[model samples]
Target chain A: MSRVLSIVTGANRGFGSSICQEFVKFSPNKEQHLDFILFARSADSLKNTKESIKTLSKVANVIEEYGVEMSDIPQVEKTFKDCLDKIEWNKYSKICLVNNHGTLYNLDKIDTFTDFQHIQKNNDINITSFVTISSLFLRKVKALPNFKDLEVTMVNITSLAAIKPFESWGLYCSSKAFREMFSNVIAEENKSSPNFKVLNYSPGPLDTDMQKEVRETCSSEETRQFYLELKKNNNLVAPGDSARALAKLVFTYEFTTGQHIDYYDIKEK
Target chain B: MSRVLSIVTGANRGFGSSICQEFVKFSPNKEQHLDFILFARSADSLKNTKESIKTLSKVANVIEEYGVEMSDIPQVEKTFKDCLDKIEWNKYSKICLVNNHGTLYNLDKIDTFTDFQHIQKNNDINITSFVTISSLFLRKVKALPNFKDLEVTMVNITSLAAIKPFESWGLYCSSKAFREMFSNVIAEENKSSPNFKVLNYSPGPLDTDMQKEVRETCSSEETRQFYLELKKNNNLVAPGDSARALAKLVFTYEFTTGQHIDYYDIKEK
Candidate 1:
């Protein structure tokens, strides 16, 4: 039987957890065994996700849970390396890495960003750790035996802010752009590897805590009103709905490598 | 008599120094008294640029030189704040900030990037320090008396890498994208201020130490050959020529705010 190992970051709540649950619903084949490794700020935080996965799939097992502080660069490196080392590479024919963890620094004009420490912390979490983990993951997996036969998929959870600048979202927009471009570079570097794929997925403005933060703290009154109206009009996307689209893209693998695919861009059959 | 205060980073050598020399050549009018503040790793490093500016325009003066380590976030904040506090805001009717300081991190494939410390350092220099200095400059200048009457221009020394991904150029490309998006947000935030403008300028391939680094350290043989061919065929741009075009863009002020103008995009008459 071919086995699959999936690793997800920020897999404790909202969209991250939803991706875990939704991915299982799409993969019910008795011939394939599924294993999961979840990462969040604390293993305890992933309890609900672990329970939900158990309810969703009897064939899927939550094999590991890592409590990680993404801003701690050294710790992040060690943790990711340890996870890869512990994995039995020959046990799985397919592997997927979801780089989904991120932080919204603040909702303020760029000129008003006065806290240097806060800015550094944000970059460490959003940019530095993302690069470190992704680089490490790719290096370790490619070194495995039968690498050419094993399927590898890398997904970057991106946003509309990655392409368009939003007022009072200076840090968030720039970090998303950085991730999307980095993913593009990865796709370019691995173009000859037919078994390798990269996807930049924008989950849309989901009804989550992040949206609530945006509505409350956005410096521009107009932007704040826009978010509030989206919520009021029921225009915000559900986490499960967006996650299903992302899973469909991952499983179908129809995208041109390095393309930015939005939740709204997906066509349901 | 109106005065212009222009602060430039990476002003010790290469394209940074060339900008200082070329900007002086463009502002030969005696009616516009020009004062400069140059930043590099050491104040002594800026001696050549200072002398070159003096030879170009008798009306231009090197007002200050700051020795800065861009990777040190706390020190960057302090140095930029000190520079702003020492400036006589009432003495200048126009202000310009050129965020030109940057480093070309090693050209290696994304998966082969193993040095976490190096990655953090790259982010600190390219993204964190740029944000710190630009924020301080904008906040300090906008708080001055008669601020609306003062013309302000902010220039980001960007590259084609800002929009395109190249194999083995992952970090460099992502950082440039981050800066470009951040510049776009600044434009969005300040759209109401008719006197405020931002420019993201791509200088093209220049005959500088950075291109030499690319020719030496690029991991991909194909990419290395591309740069090598540019140098061999005498196709590399001269720093003075590109800097002159940038000076024209800044002085003529014909571009839309936050527009990315490349060296080749300019029409010379």
Candidate 2:
């Protein structure tokens, strides 16, 4: 049977966990099996996620999990290299990388920020780490012999902040915008490579811990009010629903390269 | 007579020096005198720029220059605060800040990059410092008791990279995109105040040292070809001409707030 390699970051909880769960539920087939590599800050969370995936997939796929601190640049780089080393590239007919890990500092006014470290940490986790991880993954994928014969998809999990700027989200919003454009440029650069695709995926507001933190701890009145209203109106999408939709979009071959796909965009597709 | 504070970063040479020289040449009027604050890393280069400005305008404006490394976050913040402390806010009828300082690391393919620090430095000089400097400036400006009565303009010098990504320019391109979005957000947030304006100014390709570096050092065949073609065709705009045009756009009252103005955009307006 042909194998497929799939990697997701922040795989311990929320959208990341749900994404892995849905992928396992939907991707099992008689002709193909998955080799999963998951990343999170805690090994235990990743193990839990792996167990959940195993429960969904039965005995269909192999699973591996790693604890990686996104802010520790060297560790993140080493973990990526280690994962690539262990993957049996020739056995896999397809590979996918989903960048779902990101961090948001306390929602505070940009002007009132007391420490520059917070800004650095925000960019490091949200944007810099994304660049580093993607670069490493792309390098390895491009080096594969007979690479064009295998399918490859790299999905950058973006948010509405990528296009719209929120009041207290100056760093977070700007970093997401950086990723959006970076994804576009990468797509353009690799246009001749038919097997490779890049998608700027905006999953929309989900009932994730990230959103819950915003509703509870956001100091900006305007931002707090907006999230609170979303909850009151039951407007937030469940993580599982969004993940199922996202997994389907990831597997579909009809989407254009370097396209920005949101929940609605994928739904229409 | 009313005073106008004009601050320009990366003012040692290139477009920055030209911008200062052009500002002095154009802004001599009976109603106002400019107090120029020029920033760059080299004290000697800033002194040269100040001397050039003096030669351009006989005795029309007060000139000051400071050697500032944009990569140094603490120094950047301290210098901004010190400048604000010394400024007689009530004396100036208008104030303008031109963020012209940006660094492009030696052009290299993103995948082959061996040093992560280079990427960190690129984003720091291009986007993070811009945010820090602008936040400090805005906080001080808004604190003025009669902030609405005083005219303020924050001009961020962007490039074609802000919208279009160039080959071998991944870090440079993404950083400018971050600044572009950040500028847009700030404009939206300050919409209630009419006296404040933010311009994400795209200066276009100019006959400057940075372009010279691109023509000489760029390793990517596609990028070198594009820039070399511009030079051969004499399509690169002269720094003085672009600076003069940009200064005119900055002084205009008809421009909308939070607008992304390019050389062509302003020419049409």
- Per-model TM-score on C-alpha atoms: 0.98, 0.96
Off by over 4 Å in 2: A28-31, A60-62, B28-31, B60-63
> Model 1, A52-109: lDDT tens per residue?
9989878888999999999999999999999999988898888899999999999999
User: Using alpha carbons, what is the TM-score of model 1?
Assistant: 0.98
Could you give candidate 1's per-residue lDDT for residues B36-119 as a string of tens digits? 999999999999999998887778999999999999999999999999999988888778899999998879998898888888
lDDT of 2 by residue, B14-58 (tens): 999898877777674834677788788876778778878767666
Docking quality tier of model 2 = medium
Fnat: each model in turn? 0.85, 0.42
Clashes in predicted model 1:
0
**Which residue pairs clash in candidate 2?**
none
Error of 2 at A260 (Å): 0.2
Winner by lDDT: 1
Task: Write down the DockQ of candidate 1.
Answer: 0.90
